[model samples]
Target: MSEAKSPQSTVDVNTMTAIGAPRYGDGSVLRTEVVVRPNPRPDEILVRVRAASVCQGDAHLLTGMPYLLRLGFGLRRPKDPIIGHDLAGEVVAVGCEVTGFRPGDAVFGSVNSGAFAEYACVSAQRLAIAPTGLPLEEAAALPDSGMTALQGLRDVGQLTAGQSVLVNGASGGVGTAAIQLAKALGAEVTAVCSTRHIETMRSLGADHVIDYTTDDFTASDRRYDVLLDLIGNRSLRHCRRVLAPKGSFVSSAGAPGGDWAGPIVWMGKIVLANLFVGQQIGILLMRPRRTDLEFLAGLTAAGKLRPLIEKRYPLAQAGAAVQHVLDGHAQGKTLLVV
Candidate 1:
């Protein structure tokens, strides 16, 4: 791997735009001249993005889809100039207070912003060691998608053994991971996806599969103890119909703008709704934490959970990767092999 650009190739955020093409707006794609902050804050560490993966949220922000997320990411453009957050790489430098990681340690994690460049500054708290057994390209898949699954199902859904959980959009990014995680947590996982993807979802351990093309999952009399909705296609009423009286509904954001008025909007609505009933409905933010990554590493290291990567691209093709995620309909996560 190339050494982190010495303080030499490095320039202020205004001086550079790497080879990646940054999405400019509704009909624009720029040369991606990016701003690279020269130094880290007291709690930050600079990571060289060895590999990065695209998430649906990244694509939404890139394309200004759903329209409303513009409020949170940016009204007209993205807040982060470079749009890749699920990253894995070696740390080149650490801030004055960073202790968990040091120069040369291999790490993987997500950042609130910035991951597409050769180097990026991340809060020390957001990173965790990458899995020792996995290659950097593969480990890059964990922090964002894996942790989202772990948090959304285990933490947000409060998934437990014997509960029947339905994962909508089960063939997409977070959906793929949730199926594995729900099964690990002992839930009888039900994966809801288009007909083309039922076999794939079933291969991931979904106890039952619902093909959205042929039938409406909400119309079925079969109810669930937990509903993990990755796509917002189903209405609250639709979810409520199949929700057992004491069951809860956990929403994993997809598309954007409309499904969320920013993440806080959905979160607030769920919190408020939870007050009136035994069922729980709320948005989930799956942060990449050390413990969560480590737990997932244990699972990967053992072979219980597999990252079903759809395709891998070289770094120069990063835009195509983003576009692929935007187009949707992949069997699993799409990665950039940097």
Candidate 2:
């Protein structure tokens, strides 16, 4: 982490550049715009964003898929025009109630919808000190995927040492993080990806790597204690078949479906099926917490968690960066260098 000069001495700036989604649409609808620089609230801090990573959620926000999300985000247009959430940067200014952070301290965390900007205001409760020696861009990748993986396996799945977990769609951002976090928790990890990502999963400390292109992992006789599904393309029957008698099924997303309902339709099936099965079935929508960010930082400092970054793009090309993730072409995390 680099402790450098602060961008603002006294919150004097009035405007900054940001990627704006004026209306809900695809990545093509995103454009660069000069927006007002946000001032920190009483419980927020202003970050001079050095780097931010593109996530699948950003794509959803762009297109407003799963029309259900619009109820909260917006009915017709996004409540916020700016895009992105995961960010890493230096603290230039703090709110009146903020503590433990000072100007020039390297920090990383998820913001609501303004991380793609040159500056963003983040709630103090959502920010954490960046791990020692980790690059801001790499640390930038940790907040969203890392927290989802940690909460899904440790909190939702109740994974423990000597147990086993099989991760489907094991080459994307969340999948890669789950593979390493599961190992750190002492659970055996079987990563399921296509032929190209088999080696990527193994390099992330997965105990077993299933090539989904050449074989059907669900057909195997072996069973696992937990099934972490990042891609919800497989039917529930196929998913439950690989779990142990008391195993748990957790999904963060599903295959692209109708634009109006999207993956939520699939997620709803998991909830409806949970009542009839002996195996626990649930969907994970991570609730980000400061404590979880601290835990992930500790793991990074101890070398137990290392975010795998596959590509870097300039802030000007954020649209393409987001499209890459939406298209499911990125093998790991995709970062935007501001």
Best candidate according to TM-score? 2
- On a 0 to 1 TM-score scale, where does candidate 1 land against the true structure? 0.85
CA lDDT of 166 in candidate 2? 96
Model 2 residue 48 distance off true place after TM-score fit, in angstroms: 0.7
* Candidate 1 deviant stretches above 4 angstroms: 1-23, 26-38, 65-68, 254-272
- C-alpha RMSD values across all candidates: 4.9, 4.6
Instruction: Report the Cα lDDT for residue 267, model 2.
Output: 73
lDDT against the true structure, per candidate, is: 0.75, 0.88
How far in Å is the alpha carbon of 293 misplaced in model 1? 1.9
Model 2, position 239: C-alpha lDDT score: 88
lDDT of 1 by residue, 1-338 (tens): 11122122445544433433244442135233445444678898888778888877667677665556666677656666666778889998899988878888998888776676667788887888877678877887777788888888788778788889988888987888889988888889889889888888888998899898998999999989889888777667778889998887887763333543544555566677778777777678766677887898788777778788989976556666777776668779988765
TM-score of each predicted structure versus truth: 0.85, 0.94
lDDT per residue, candidate 2, 94-203, as tens digits? 99999999999999999988998899999998899999868877899999999999999999999999999999988999999999999999999999999888888998
